[model samples]
Target: MTKLTGRLDDDRRTLVLTRQFDVPAEQLWTDFTDPDRLERWFGAWTGDPASGQVMLTMNAEAESVPAVPCRILHCDRPRRLSVTVTDSFGTWQLAIGFDEDEGSTRLTLRHEEVDLQTVPEVGPGWEWYLDRLTAAVAGEAPPTLEDFVDTYAPMGQDYAVMISGS
Candidate 1:
């Protein structure tokens, strides 16, 4: 696995993050694209990326995770999905690709458009969220953002520091 690293440029205020997860790409795609499967890992899911609708709530069995209205900017199955999230001043693209490794899938994610405004929370918060995602794909329930909000706040700044090539 590689330490996730990327940068923002003068032309773009986006922070592109990539991470490799030991999971199958298709399975990763399912968890990310399919609402039913997504809820198993995501605290809340609303709609289907495959269907071009937002899956903001996870399972009907789970409490509704609020949905931020987003437009599907790109939906390349088993590869990429770009969505514009509300409360977020940027368009985020989530890309899932694979490299075969020792009989497991190395799932890489690229989250684009994380500018000055988005960088703070997305960095450190991503640590917990990505951890939850890894677990979700591994068939476990993910901890809610509510469970780690306070902890992530200060730490996220530190996270950006580390990510900024320090």
Candidate 2:
């Protein structure tokens, strides 16, 4: 499997994560927008994610985190999705772009309007989630949250330093 890394853009106040998947854009789109497929890697959402507001329960084990309310900003199938998510912390703007190549897809996830201080925490979490997505696409078991945290925690510091230096 290919390793994925996220780039923190201080000027734009966005955390950009890019990954190349061996699957087609349609498959990648389903993995991202379908509730059943999303639950495999990210979270399960209720309500209409395609048009209106939805409540997302992070992890199938709802006890892990409270449900977050998110408003769908834009939903262009197999191409782009933008949403504003509100949780205990605050509201966040997220946009995902998918570009299809010959037999693969390039996915770029941008977390816009991010706080510089939280990059350390947020960046690694996204990395772990993306890795889980990769595993899901490959029909492999996703890593547990604890395992992901333990393995990627150190990379958070590296993200912090990179963000601080830039």
Candidate 3:
């Protein structure tokens, strides 16, 4: 996976991460959009996720957003999926994609349009979550973001503050 700190869609403020996955497109898509499939490897969703469905309050624990609610923007089986969210940081797109690769599929997922200035919490976050994703798909243990905010977010804040100070 190639992770770069830069703009997406030519927007200088947006950050894009392009990554490749080794699984078939269908499997990856199911794992991404299906709440049940996600719960199998990730956290337990308080409810199911379907296109146009309004997320329930219980889903706050496991959902498209951990810190806040978000809307499911697009879901195209085995190819593309995206979500739209607005936080204290800013508005942005989170997306997943898959392509045919010698019978398997090449996957690229991104957390795009993030405000690096406001949401300083997302830099090390992508690296940390992507690492968990690799482990999750491989049937291994992955740490929960909710479980690690105290551990990683503070460190992230300090690191960003340091970078900005310099």
Best by TM-score: 2
Model 2: colliding residue pairs: none
**Residue 115 lDDT, candidate 1, scale 0-100:** 57
TM-scores vs. true structure, each candidate: 0.66, 0.91, 0.64
TM-score of 3: 0.64
For candidate 1, lDDT tens digit of each residue in 53-93? 56354232234445566567776666665665553344455
lDDT of each candidate versus the true structure: 0.57, 0.84, 0.57
For model 2 the local lDDT of residue 16 reads 96
Better of 1 and 3 by TM-score: 1
Ranking by lDDT: 2, 3, 1
Q: Write the per-residue lDDT of candidate 2 for residues 66-160, one digit (tens) a residue.
A: 88898999989889999999998899899999999997999999999898888888888788888888889999998776766577656787788
- Tell me the tens digit of each residue's lDDT in model 3 across 19-72: 456777887777766666665544333433564533322222244544445577
**Model 2 poorest 10 in a row by lDDT:** 1-10
**Candidate 3 residue runs with Cα over 4 Å from true position:** 1-10, 40-51, 56-68, 86-91, 144-166
Better of 1 and 2 by TM-score: 2
Candidate 2 similarity to native, TM-score: 0.91
